[model samples]
Target: MAADIRQLLLAAFEVEHHEHIAAIRGALGSATPDWNDVFRRAHSLKGAARAVDLPAVEAVAHRLETLFERVRNGASALDRDGANAVHLALDRIESYVAGLKDGAGPDMPGDALAALGRYLGLHGLAPEASAPPAASRAPVAAPVAAAPAPKAPPEPAESGAAILRVPGEAVEALARASHDLASTLAAQAPAAEGLARLARLARDLRAGAEVLAAGAETERPELRAFAARLGSFAREAAELSRRQGAATSAIEAAAVRVHAGAERLALVPAETVLGPLARSIRETAREQGREVDLDLQGLDLPVERGTLQALKDPLLHALRNALSHGWQQPELRRAAGKPEALGLGLEVAVRGSRLQVTVSDDGPGPDLTRIEAAARARGLLAPEGPADSETLLRLVFEPGFSTAEAVDTLSGRGYGLSVAADAARQLLGSVRLEPREPAGTALVFSLPLSAARRSLLLVEAGGRTYALPGGVVERLLRLERAGLPLAMGRTILRHGAGDAATSHPVTDLAEILGPVSAAPDPGNPGGAPPDPGILTAVLLRAGGGRLALAVDRLHDVRSLLVLPAPSFGSDPGLVAGTAVLPGDVPVLVLDPEGLAARAAVTSAVVSAGTMAQAPRSTTASRATARATILVVDDSITTRTLEKGILEAAGYRVVVCVDGQDALDRLRAEIEPVDLVLADVEMPRLDGFGLLKALRADGRFARLPTILMTSRGDAEDVARGLDLGADAYLTKQKFDQRQLLDTIGQLL
Candidate 1:
């Protein structure tokens, strides 16, 4: 039943979008204008907008609808100016409707919308005798010209009814099924083996709702809206399934309730987003002195209105970046062995409670030398030296930093990337850049989603109620509180000082909650009256890590629906997972490894049982010994990963943060290095220019150099490797093993 409703809603968006397109085209047609189609399309769009309670969209569509009504009734005929005005008005209406369909409609500025309406009124002919379509073939070529048609006051039954009707049962049934499936998966041989099955079922169920909401050709708008709610539920269900653990029961339960709430919110089809972006790319490329073909896959997928709305700016920025920085001229593309016309592709897929969106382009990749020069000139790099490509690439994300030689209004102010990143993060999403294989660049985004709660377990922490997975709990223990000893600082311990057995970490449940826990440990006793202390330590394992967390107390676990994480605030010890409990409280599930790591960092070094024999530490004694490779990058994660891979491959790895550091280390070394594996976009000195500088000096002229940066443009490669570089590899396209393999081959 719910599935039926969802189909109706999905259909409504499709039909509405189609009608808007038709109306815009019909108004722009170069014949005796078909006022009937325009009126019908506008009327349908207005109704659909109102059905979704998109008042902003409804207003624009309503005005357009009214304009067509006068024409249809033979009350007026549009003249040349009126035709232009009508076309412009239709364009605005189409954008507005499309925005609503895509979920980004609410934020459209009132002033802009009103200005379009005013333009229509000023340019339109009053009660004309002969109406004519303008000479322009496309809606974008003309201005808005039409008088404002007044709207009748909305009736409650029609306007308010669309806002009502929530699905309670479907949410409840699916949420329960999700909880049971979660438990079954945990108890089975492999925890993750059956998760995908659950996701598919949930998707199907949600899709059913969409079909219901959208399929009925004559269904009321409110019915279509009811289906939108189901889609939101389906989205949440998929998310919860991804992070299923013992602690998720209550979260699933709470999700049922949240689903009810989410259903009331507006929804949009995924196509709404894909269409405008594709169209804009086609239009923008012509102006940017390039040709681009936009390819969007999975347009039939539905996204929550909120998610779609939040996605607009980021998507737009990414498109602009692709065109401005990624695409090249037809000749250039052909020279690079790519299609003459550059191609930009957008792909969206769901992974657990996360949505993955990718935007990739086939064009000239970034130019590291230019980036290096720009960084040096901007003084972003220290005077000590320029940085490598890796460091320089990172600077592009910094606010107010632009690597472009000339600032264009379209880009290079250095704000878009950061802003887009910020938007995605707000949705508990992250974005990463990968150099396109062979050529160009690709940007990937991941977003968290709300899910249904199946089970819930609560833990007390820092004087408040915290949550954990019931599946994660091995067992709960009770011990007598009096048996524990105290250190000089009054810190409780299992035993006295100097005794390894005596100094067990002691935690009170009360201490965790900032309250006095009177519950005594059942084990320890005999000293005296029990002090006001209680402790509960939860043992958990997650993400290949394990640890015990001290909480105030254990609370009852129950099922509930959960919401998606808002884009900010790291919940302490909380893995990137959430659960729902009663009252729709989102319980952040703890990551045992992440929590234990924090504790491990604070504790004195736990001894590694034994150390592998180290090669004798030598000073700079062998000045011209066997070759050395210098690896430089600011990201410790990247550095570590690279170092491990290099060491495993039997190469001496010297890691540095920037070019200056590399040079310093080299000068200090007893042996002249054999090779340099440097990134071009570093903070100190970049790769291309760094090699040029090193070659300028007499000492390092013959250095076998390989530039490893994220810049993969043909020109960048040709300029660097052609000059002196033995090899060049974009970081995004090169895995550590692959990089090591390349280095081995290069040397």
Candidate 2:
């Protein structure tokens, strides 16, 4: 019986206890208090506390119950002191409950209990007698007159209709089953298409048979019989096609229902997490002696449970930053002609197939001057020129980068935005700072609705199938060979006509991913064309620029179930994941942002190399005729800075974001490149890989190369030089003159 009571107390008592405390607090300073209702709630809490053998909790509740009973019986009047005492008692009870929940023995501050007793005595009420020795009476960091028995085991929290706690494993299992079913259904699509083709052929056959029957004479028995047989076969084929079509439709509907149900089960309403978030903001504001109004929109929007869990910390960090940094003091706001209480708003909505959540605060936007100053101090900005808005904004997300003058508990350490950005990346989402109109700043997070399932455009490149997320692709084009122009030793495509015409850098997908021995073009009759080839470009919108990826062929669009790549030490950044296509064919899903960055760097590097060998004649020389050099690095800022410095020195510069891209460009270049300057550590492939590839190739074996990287350890330098590098330089010791002299000597 004691064990049963303990379970009940743990499961349901805490919730009831919290409600009672809230009621007591709410009734404070009221014109008329509900004495009878308060008495009943206190009585119930006291009984549950006694059953659980928590003497400290029961004592506080018992005192409250007695006082409220007096008020209900009209023996005592509720006064301000009485309200104060009740609040104190409730606070003490909450502390004990917290201790028990922490697996510490049920305990409370003895002084607080004594204070409550003294207050009751002044009201002409006698204090309740202490509990018997059998009850738990653990001391809270102090010795007591008598101690009770050992504490009982803690039980699970009570279940409620308002919230459900589902096991993570169960959710994962359901997701896998759904994905498998979808894959199977996708495989059946081709068979349905085949049925349609068969039906068309059957109709054509019947038409031919009718013509033959009309032409045939009755005297020719064999010809008539042949025509009749053909007509019968055509009718049978048509009937079979009709039945298959209906069955296919039914199967498709069932698959859609299953997929929809599974996705819904894996998601929860956005409001599920927003309630606690709002409470946290209010409590933090109260602590800081500030007034804030937080409004949440689209609370009913559904988001994946995993995504919500990942976003919890990031959202908390954002809120803290908004309160501590984005909002102005109440008095300051009034002086600035704004509302006394700052407004912080969070709006979540489904945009197309993605979920976008924006957090905005009505305060002065971030100071660009301060951010630029910080970037300069951290050596992240160019000294001669002012940083762009995008560059300055990106500085806020850098680790240990802050504009605050001093450190504090809230945000000065500079980990908030960095952590938020990192979390977004891990979830395959992006976070950006948007400029709000008039004033304030908005942080936007865009994430896939279902990370596992996504709409992908399948294409064939290098004789291999790869999937590109449909969201990033702008358009597909088959441009004439004559329209492609060679600029700075790279191919450029002119898109649109008339006023909207714009030129974009074009890269062959086969060159970026690796070469597949040129296969015969099925579309072309004879063989591979000479000189210029017809370009099939996939225009992509990445960052603030447009990139065109030239692929061999384009296939159908499909909604694929993307699975995580196996952890066998392969490059996962370039290949986001893998998906099983129709006919059980597996295809790699490409990360477009990474690909675009690589393409930009590659084009820059190739241009640099081409300029190095250019003729000096002003009339005869083109931009590609100058001394060309290739600069490779993963950081866009670093790559841009290097390109600027080299280009300013009269050298044509091309940049590659990583080693793999550099190697690909080197292999695909028709003209010889003069030099290769690359960073040491990068994704997909590193500097050593590039150097090794260059040395192994007969054409580039004697090409001048320099390694510039942040890894400046003696052993690293030695390793790079040993791998056939002409010179190895550390970024910490980088100098424009020194780099130029090294390249000149090597060339």
Candidate 3:
């Protein structure tokens, strides 16, 4: 239990530590540093380190708190040397945490405190403090250099440790990133709560000061100065509280970015992840006294690791099954004038957006007679009816139907082919047993290919919005969740009323994605409404199966690029990647096949908190910064004028060269803002196109948008509004005050 607790603390510390590093780094580099915020971060990090038993980290953090405390108290100024020392300390802490693995983290670098102590002019500080807070506790240990960050996220995986490329660096990068998102398990609620308490206390103190001002004590000049200071303190506290809330959201957004960037490493050759499987097969053959030639092809072709992992099990089963039933003795092969060794081949290829993996063997084709007999004995086929070759071959997949006269290690209680079939079905693919030319058999598994999914189905489950592959969407519909038919302890969604209705087992999307999560979306609520189930639902199809995924809302469908799944928060099985929505929102792109397979595991009517569902969306909009306004125009004059106006109005403004530039910025989310102001007439993707793109994206569909152009035609106004622009303004009759008012109303 103690070990378990220590591990949990390590996990929490991992997240907390990364976030503190980011916060502290930002503060140190800021021209106008938030000294109080820096002090709190150091204090929090110290506590987190102590909890995780990282004495070196705790010791460094303690000295940092003292340094920042003195700075805030005006006892010392933060100069070049001081800042360098702080950065060195942060680097040391990051390096130490990055080296941690499944158990207690790698020992922290020893010189973290020494650097900070040197900056503080402490002669007694040890280079490696063995015991945290050991002013008199223990002797100093030797100094150790800090670890360096990985060059990148990681290369795509190939199985087996010996042959796999540099993965330790990747693991370190992941561990380093594993929750900031060490993508931040953004645990800043306490910070926010602490701010709230501070605000209340300051408010009370200010009230007391005001009372003093109203009394005869106001005559005292010192009392007046004290009152003014109290008023300023209260105001600052209130501002901090508001900013803390936004900071929490910003941290969540940064977590998304870190994880999404990791996707850049997602693409790699199939051999990267499949080499180990092939080697394993070779070893198995040697042990079984079987001689086989492995004909592996198309493995050089690039594919995502997620897709490769899903294919791993079926391929293994298929290869082993070939060894068991498809291999013939060398004597029989010579009589047949065939190769002495069995030809077992695995071939992968892509046809459009579909992927196919064929496992083949040049041996006696499937025994139709044996399969037919098994089917008949098992009552899967009529005993008297003539069985076709196809029917007999497919019957080999029947559970518990085996041709082996006796159960053995190799073949018994037929489950290999069945496993392949189940996997194929789950992938929305099919497993077909076909007779290869000239005495051989091939099992083909076909399914939708995994790539950078551009066409997406936007959906809301719980309170967060997620992106699903548009290809998997069979249809969209609304099913009343209040009174659904029950069968075998499952809620069945019927397409039609009464007996004519087609039944599909209903599974709440939230049940799969988990309890509602995310910061308050300016556009949508954070979770499901008071009513748990919504009328909106999406009917999803994957491979050979279909599922009715009940959801809080069905947002919109758009074509967009996808990034890698977050390492810390998401389930590797469910989330394939993260899609950046318009307005720079990062949403999870769920695996439809995974969802289809989850129907059985997720109780139909259970609470929506069963699975450890990754948080789907973070606050995409920038916090701390003023409400950003994206100004799109081809003319430099128009862009300059609009930018100046918005900036003067207390809005942070970003100008794009044209509609295309604006659209690109929005798509890349380089500038996540609260609203968009664009000129309708521009080169390469007009305002209409931008507006249409924004409306089509679920993230920015409801984003406040305004169309301001020279054109004053009624037709243009009608068209702009039809495209979902919140407001249409014309420069021909432009009023500066009117523009600000309109923007104000929208914001």
Better of 1 and 3 by TM-score: 1
Pairs in clash, predicted candidate 3:
158-272, 158-273, 177-182, 178-182, 179-182, 180-184, 181-184, 428-542, 428-543, 463-527
- The TM-scores, one per candidate, come to 0.36, 0.40, 0.32
Per-residue accuracy of model 2 over 234-317 as CA lDDT, tens digit each:
777778778876886576557556656655666677755553465466556645756675667786677766787788778878
Regions of candidate 3 where Cα sits further than 4 Å from its true position = 1-187, 190-226, 235-317, 320-382, 386-394, 398-747
Give candidate 1 regions above 4 Å deviation. 1-269, 272-275, 298-304, 384-386, 450-574, 578-747
Ten contiguous residues with the weakest lDDT in model 1: 607-616
- Of models 1 and 2, which has the larger TM-score? 2
List, residue by residue over 169-271, the lDDT tens digit for candidate 3: 4733542343233212323444566788899998898888777767863377777788889889989999989988677656555654554444334445676
lDDT of each: 0.54, 0.67, 0.67
Ranked by lDDT, the better of candidates 1 and 2 is 2
Model 2 spans > 4 angstroms off: 1-242, 350-355, 367-393, 401-409, 428-435, 446-747
lDDT of 3: 0.67
